[model samples]
Target: MPPTSPSRCRSDGVHLVLPIVERSSKEPSAHEPWYCIIFSHRLTSSPVESIQSTFSPLSGLINGIFFTVIQINTDVRSAAALLDQFYEKRRILIVSTPDISNQYYKLQNIMVQRAGCGLDLRQVTVIELLGLPPREVGRIKENRLSSEVIEELRQAMRISQAYFTMVLVDKQGMDRERYIDPVTSDELFSYIDTYMLSTEERERMENNRDHCD
Candidate 1:
């Protein structure tokens, strides 16, 4: 049979082209190798060269086919603009590191994950900027921040992607604390209650704490 043509489709401003090579029934292993290519309008013609690749030795194949996720951000906001949304509403915890596997990053994640309720009551939002050159803006118990926002944040914070740094920004959009090492959730909560929270907020937090307990 003639080789199957590549199928093309577009959705939500994203363009995807999938090329499939059928495996022979008698000699499936001998079939020609094919690639699944994805084309995004936001990306250059050759995004594959830039997109990260992960291969699994156990499966002896790429874990997933090549496809650039279309992150839809209608109105991309600057770092300051993005952070402004949380001001007077939620305290921001910005964590920047070279990789997600960093010891301090993992420790911080565990600590935050354990104190979800406390963080919520304190109106704390954690933003993780993991990996550099093309850093990924992630959210802990919230929505992911866009790359544009992350880039602006990188500039605003003057973060050194080569090392681990965690900054605590209050609801007023001011950096209140900076940590080079992992901080305990209890320590974080104590600091926020002591310095960051208003009297009314503290009272509310106390009431919420009682119910949570």
Candidate 2:
């Protein structure tokens, strides 16, 4: 296989593979660094050596980029369990659209790009589900969810893939806010502060609101 060719390994009905992203000049200003997600799901006596030998040629390339695997099992229970990992740890902001060219998605991406500090401060993980399957899943920063997982999220939220939709899931893994149109950073921050944050978090947010911008 070529150095950049994605090696596919299956686990619980999901495939973990590397992504080859082709960007265009008309695309929004989201810089995605090259990443590799390589691992074997089935445990074997020599799994480590097997994986190392398979991608040995690409070792240098892999080391040059940031990489981690996000696997999604299509089973209903597994999907829920996958999301459970984020429960009580991070708030989820899911942004989905049929395509990235949607005006609402573009605006949301720009807003999110500018509000990284605020998102980090609030422990929010932005998951962008752009484009249709069997196309590759989209990545916003380091979060690249599988198409199956994205579909699960869409179905869970009852969001139509034909339109732009944004859903905010709080730390407790509950849907707190939904928007069909683009939302501003100030609005998101205010909502989180009012409804999701604890008293201490709210006070800290008040003190650091200016820094988040």
Candidate 3:
């Protein structure tokens, strides 16, 4: 079964519509969340380099989790464009060094794939980083960013030629979590899904309270 649209869809757009079965049949529905997982720089071009999306099929636990992990090759301008679009919208970003071989990035690859993982991708944009030479960035390369934005990120994230890091940017586009060299996969996973997710929710709850007050 594919997504059905009540109205016409654009040729260039992606439309996936599924019935909300768990929700009440009498009540109106809202939009489903979309998750974007960015790959900051050149991939190793190895099969193992990918974030494995496979999950256990036990008891249809996956559908309860409704997020998709989209790996965008750097292509800096497009990435910059995407960031601009998402920053004001519902998105969370995960930034990491270019080395996908790093333990942290791989953990995110797993975290992004889980159902009921407790993070909403539609409201979050994930950013991963690389250590590429500025001269290597070009229109043709998929893993590149605007020079100005790159400089901004380099300064904000304290990127260097020496360390592998992962920086988590919250919905406000503020840096939430930063992990540098020698961080283990267990530590990385906990930092992101546990602490970060809880902090994000806590802020959201606070905002909702503020709004109602």
Q: Which candidate number has the best lDDT?
A: 2
- Whole-model Cα lDDT of every candidate shown, in order: 0.58, 0.60, 0.39
On a 0 to 1 TM-score scale, where does candidate 3 land against the true structure?
0.40
The residue ranges of model 3 lying beyond 4 angstroms of the native Cα positions read 1-84, 101-122, 134-148, 181-213
| Preferred candidate (TM-score higher): 1 or 3 | 1
Summarize candidate 3's per-residue lDDT along 1-213 as a digit string, tens digits.
Answer: 111322211111111212222333343222232223221122233212122232221111122332233323333443354455455433444444455565755665565444112233223434445446654232211233556666556665465644556565664566666656444444544565455555645554343322211
Give Cα distance to truth, residue 170, candidate 2, Å.
0.9
lDDT of 2 by residue, 136-205 (tens): 4655445455566667777776778788989999878788889999989999988987789888667655
Per-residue lDDT, model 3, residue 43, is 26
Where is the poorest 10-residue window by lDDT in model 3?
8-17
TM-score, cand. 1: 0.61
* Candidate 1: Cα lDDT at 78: 74
- Each prediction's RMSD to truth: 16.7, 12.6, 14.7
**What's the count of clashing pairs in each model shown?**
0, 0, 22
Model 1 scores worst on lDDT over the 10 consecutive residues at 6-15
